[model samples]
Target: MDSVYTDVGQARKAVEQHLARACAWVDMGGVLLVVSELVTNAQRHARGQWQLRVQAERHRVRVEVSDSVPLPPRWRPGKLDGSGGWGLRIAEQCADTLEVLTSARGKTMRAQWLHPGRTGVAVA
Candidate 1:
């Protein structure tokens, strides 16, 4: 459903927990990274609180972070030197489908990744 995360660490734990055994197929490390970026961006760039919503299907998992600010996310070109402004790029690279939706009130950054396997849990 929907949740509000004041802290990035706690939000990550909740996301992993909710995804359950499905994380085995969805690359949990990548998923968590995307979540961290989205949530942190919302907190740092937007006013008021941020909301986290996740939807897990048979083939893919989608994570969305919404905020009150209507400003759109900026995409920075790839670079060898690691620095700021890389969050959007990282999410774009990791996700199967990445989107930024803007409305009159605010915007939502959505990241989706396909599961690695069709089974309940992928074998390691």
Candidate 2:
């Protein structure tokens, strides 16, 4: 599935609806949430439209979001007061592999989570 979100709010709903159909109900929530965060980040920080793709493969499910900026995501420690910058941190913990690829056209953030049989294990 592929979607184009112009803003953060749209991306959230798009992720949830799309992931729910692509992944199992039990794992849909986590995958959707992670995809939402990634898409939201791109929508907020990047210039043009953001693209999202969710696919279910043999042993895992993959979510990829592309933006109009070549810069990769930043993973800085959160502030004490009330600021939050922990999206990438949470995604790293949840996903088996989280990759950020940058090019002149844009940057793509891809997150992969394993299926039940794989138990989130990486294949070598």
TM-score for candidate 1, residues paired by index: 0.80
Write out the backbone clash pairs for model 2. none
| Deviation from native of the Cα of residue 61 in model 2, angstroms | 0.9
Model 1 superposed RMSD (Cα) = 5.2
lDDT of 2 by residue, 1-124 (tens): 2334145566657666665666653366677678767866765677546887777766777888887788887788977675768778877777878999899988889988777677757653
Task: Specify the highest-TM-score model's number.
Answer: 1
Q: Model 2: runs farther than 4 Å from truth?
A: 1-21, 119-124
Per-model TM-score, in order, reads 0.80, 0.76
Error of 1 at 62 (Å): 0.5
Residue 43's C-alpha lDDT in candidate 1?
72
> What residue pairs clash in candidate 1, if any at all?
none
lDDT by residue (tens digit), candidate 1, 1-124: 2335248888898889978865557878888999998887777678547889888877878899998788897776657676568888888888877898899989999998876655465322
